[model samples]
Target: MTTQKKVSRQVTLELEAGNAAMVDIGKMLGPTGVNTRQLKLDYDEATAPQRGEIVPVVVTVFEDRSYALRYKTPPTAHLIRKAVGLEKGAGRPGSQTVAKLSREQLREIAERKLPDLNTDDVEAAMRQIAGTARSMGVLVAD
Candidate 1:
């Protein structure tokens, strides 16, 4: 007997942890599907960080109405805020500095974000993070 292979489709969504909706998910599932309830549960379970941060998710829906989920890291701007303990970035980024970070602190952030950063070494990752921080009105010191 020949084996049948189920085809899977991928949909990327920026879902707030534990607060997904049927309408948003239904749009991805299309008119022919009815497994949105299960998909919502899966999204909530996968993003249990409790901070309600928006996360990029890749949902692979199979032919049988079953789905797999992949959660990506939070954005660099969010990570920088957490690292600097700020509620928001500076409004006037060029004229105002909201926070500061040491080289060691930047390095730690770089290491934590190494998996998500598109860089070969920690130094390059740190540079990228530094650029993000600067854009957010955070000064990085040596």
Candidate 2:
């Protein structure tokens, strides 16, 4: 006999700090019964440094149609970007920055918003923020 399957849906799963400790990975999977173990591991690794934040994960379907998952940090450095309320692909803090950006920039960042950034390092935060800008089409002068 032969077996094959395809992914049916993509979800922006919400995960918290202690998501791993929970045993029922299946319940969060919904009625589809998609396996959450691998997905949970991916998410945990990607967002381990900032465990509390809700990281963006890409869930793909395998040929058997079960499901495969991968995690990415907002697909475009959004965690820190959305924190300062700046534009996507926008500017940095030191090289002439502003507390409030233009409306379009705000909208752009908002559209590509990351779940929540619970970090303390400003530099690391900025790097993450700048990535959002680049993804949003903002070109850094440097």
Q: Best candidate, lDDT-wise? A: 1
Candidate 2 minimal-lDDT segment of 10 residues: 93-102
lDDT value, residue 77 of candidate 2: 41
Give the per-residue Cα lDDT of candidate 1 at 2. 100
- In the range 27-128, model 2's lDDT, one tens digit per residue, is 646456655666567657766786655555556655444766555444344443454554443345345334443445544444444334445554454455
lDDT of 1 by residue, 12-49 (tens): 88777778867888887765374888878878886776
Worst 10 residues of 1 by lDDT: 46-55
What is the TM-score of candidate 2? 0.39
Best by the TM-score measure: 1
Error of 2 at 106 (Å): 11
Candidate 1: Cα lDDT at 127: 96
